[model samples]
Target: MNFILYAVPFFVVLIVLELIVDRWRGVSNYRLADAINSLSTGVLSTTTGLLTKGVGLVTYAFALKHLAVIELSAESAWVWVFAFVLYDLCYYWLHRMGHERNILWAAHSVHHQSEDYNLSTALRQTSTGFLLSWIFYLPMAVLGVPLLVFVSVAALNLLYQFWVHTRHIPKLGWFEWFFVTPSNHRAHHAQNALYMDRNYGGVFIVWDRLFGTYQEEDDNDPAIFGVTTPLASWNPLWANMQFYAQLWNDARRAESLWDKLRIWFMRTGWRPADVAAKYPMAKPDLSQFRKFEVPLDGRQQLYVALQFGVYVALGSYLMNLADSLPTAALVLGWGAVAFGLFAQGAALENRPWAFRLELLRLALNLPLVWLAPLAGLWPASAVAWVGLLSYSLFSVIGLYCCRNRITRLAS
Candidate 1:
């Protein structure tokens, strides 16, 4: 019943179509490194959810069992209607708090790190959101909303938000008043002084309007996407950990115990005076802003794209097999994904160690193909074996052919 899985092909197709439109229209909303980093964080989030999702599910189930006041039926059309609206209401608070608070923002900031506003940026999600996101929806469980209805509405809400991440869609006038559209959502994503911390709705913008947090997109002031503290690296792991690491460092440097304890729960961007003075974080001046970029030839771009495609395939396969796979198998699959993403990030950054790490990934895959079936990590199929071999062979040959180009560029 996971609609996102079923919608994955359509998402891929639409992203491709969007890219084509972007190129044709002379609007450069898709940067190779940024898009890859966005999708990599998304892939990491989805893969990590396979393991951490139990926390949310178990808590919801427990609450529903003991705390339910009235049992809601999924079979009722009215129940579906109510659940859909209620879910969004709950989501509004979660979304608002995610931006307003420090610890939650640490997890939520992954989505805002992308400098470009495009379809890929929609997929850029936080892997750690499961740690606290489920807490917001306990109300639904307490009110006796059926688990089936809750899950369905949650997926629908998420799918509804996907199209709003595009730059191609302009405001839809009256529709803009009720729902979250590309224009208003873009304002929400902006770091502009006028646009920051406004429009915190997912499927519905009414919540923001009601709560006095809504900001309409302005013609004079263009939206500048990305967080105030830029995530300069292409690495997804680093992107997720960046804010949390900053919070941890600030906490450690605090002279007062109360300051150390309160710094985390305080407003997002609030720092102790001593910590702020000692380590003044450079906030980007939006008037003189520039998107992060790396010099890479077309060959390197193609190679990174191909490798990312492979990871996407593997990630899809792992998701399909997630429930059936043993714990160790899931861990191995997740590790492979992390490694691929890490090495690719390095390659995009033009790091000298990237080439060696990529080679190591391919070499490691050979043994994985041999051992996976026995470990029940992968199926024992001749075609699967051949496919892995073919991929490894071609990747090595591709790297070899592109060696001089990579070296010359690095030099």
Candidate 2:
């Protein structure tokens, strides 16, 4: 049940294999800091997945309670095959819309913040994408394509995308016309004008080709990576909220109510006429832009990588514990979930709120510890509760140290 125990090893295997191929081929689109940041953010996404998907699943369950839909046990292989294609079609539109609309881009831009594209880039997923993304696939539920079929195919589509993030793969000849090969996907990840807002495919390039969003990777021009408004730091939390915070500020500063509401749905970089007057720009020159590389203060990179490992261990343990716990079990599980969000937010924000979240960890767990005895799970309950309490205290002290260091730096 410890998915990361196996998943981490598997990722390591793939990463090592990718390293060998890149070195042998004299191809590298990798930077150590970026790789660490991408991997750290991805592992955090997995840690927080239940929250993202949990909200949608609950809403759908309540809304569809009248109907016995979303069921699937024994699906045909061909059903899965068809589901993969169908899901990709849905994803293509969702992805394209993410670029066209400002709010959606807030969720999707997390993937594009990476300057260096490599295996690690594929791991960079947006946890908040579930906000509106699940709505796009509801049509499948409406059509009665059982939940199992949809989920399996969606997972497979994800697996297929992992291999395409590399910079080493050339166009696969005629396969370029059909599947989402590296060349095509590379264009999707590019920030170049010719490449932006194009190639929005998940598994098949056919969607992009048919949608008129297709743009070939031009060897002469070369691709410039990252977004129009770059994320200056390597923090995953900042990566997720950079656009969102910008939009919030814009809305707050807008002159009228209409401008406030419209600012969120406007085209990717479009601003209100008044706002545009203050912030003019020239065309982006790819050659003049700084090289796409990771930004890490060496030690911060190591600290984050280690924190990623701890989260993997903690999340895996919680998954197993959640499966068997009685009603009381869920209390601790939710506590763990809150703690996860707080831990990530603290590292990402490192502000006053971060300290508040850390302090609340003990209060969150006290109920779980109190109820465990009534469930008659003494030994296991005792150990986990004690461990969690100790960890919370340690985190509190750690935050205090960080706060002191910041105070000293400011003084």
Candidate 3:
């Protein structure tokens, strides 16, 4: 049923609510550029995963499809509860490993690159995590937990983790000892040393507390979020490529054959001996690092809130149209829209090139959407062409207005 797709409605609502409430502290890191950039990366990650889903379908059909392997125990609700608990336990391990192992970290680091955490942070999920994550749930499938229960609990496990990404909440007294609270998770999101790699639970802090991996959110030690290596550039493709490219360079520069092969699985930050001394590791000075604060005017939050809502609505409608029309419709029409959004984000970030690109989309929308969709001036689909033409016309005009403003500001 594509629950992830269905979840977009709730996501839209949450982002809009986040805006209307105007949460500066929570939305502190939220910026228009960050939102647009992270989302562009997110869209690319999702597109990449769709290419990977074929691999999943084959694995499920050939290897894991047999129904006989699953046995749902009918005797107790306690089993359902146990499945939920175990899922979090698995999640804790996977989350911990993602931080500890550089190979996995490449895929996982995309989520952490955002200097600011917000509703966009929630969407910043790694589409590539599907590679290893599904394995953790096999025990549930093996134990005969109904796929239905397994999926419901998995969804709940995921949904529960969403609210914890913010800076809004404070420490709950003993609640920290049990469930994963927002306070506990803020510590997880912090770039500070002591907080790094601690608090790995998805829904239950008890797993972390029980495992002795827990740390409290220190009011004294605030979070300086984002990776040690910056995602300073705004390109979405570059954001996904950043860590992997770093790893690739390290492997190439390694002094020995053993070092080259060992790099990926080594304790994530490890480097070859000569390289280490040359690039001698600076012990991270916590004293020099301070918590990140958003310098934006309060009204920019209003701009972010309004524009983000508009994008989500636009994305949602495009998706719905994809479903209503033929597969060709989705590939040709929806894909064009997504590509255009990415192109638009790239244009906005590149000051020298932005206005020209904006003008191009403004000019081409009718040719791209209308003439392209309705088979070009054939009388049969003239009405369909009109609807598309109208949308293209509005979009072109809008782009022209934005272009005019950019030119004014530059001069």
Q: For all candidates, what are the clash counts? A: 0, 0, 2
Candidate 3 structure, TM-score to reference: 0.79
Across 1-411, the per-residue lDDT of candidate 2 in tens digits comes to: 333334556667787888999899897767666775676567556645644556656544443444545543335676566667788998898989999999999999999888888888888878678888877776656545565566666777777888888887887899989988888888888988789899998888898889798888889767777887877665666777889998887777667789889988888876677656665545557677885443333433344455455655655654556446454444444445445544544444344465565556545556656655566334455577877677657656665666566567669
Tens-place lDDT per residue, model 3, 1-411, is 556668766766876677655564343446677776667666655545544554534443333346337555636698789878877887888888898988778878888877776677767766567776665555555556665566567778877877776665678788888889888887887788889888988888888888789999888888777777767755666677787887788888878999898888888788888667666646446567543333333333343334334445545554444435444444454354455554555553454665566556556655655555553222247575676567656655655565566457659
Give lDDT per model, in order: 0.92, 0.70, 0.66
Q: Compute the lDDT for candidate 2.
A: 0.70
List the pairs of residues colliding in candidate 3.
Answer: 71-144, 72-144
lDDT (10s digit) by residue, model 1, range 109-203: 99999999999999999999999999999999999998888989999999999999998999999999999999999999999999999998999
Which one wins by TM-score: 2 or 3?
Answer: 3
Query: Each candidate: RMSD to true structure?
Result: 1.4, 5.3, 4.7
TM-score of 2: 0.77
- Per TM-score, the best of the predicted structures is 1
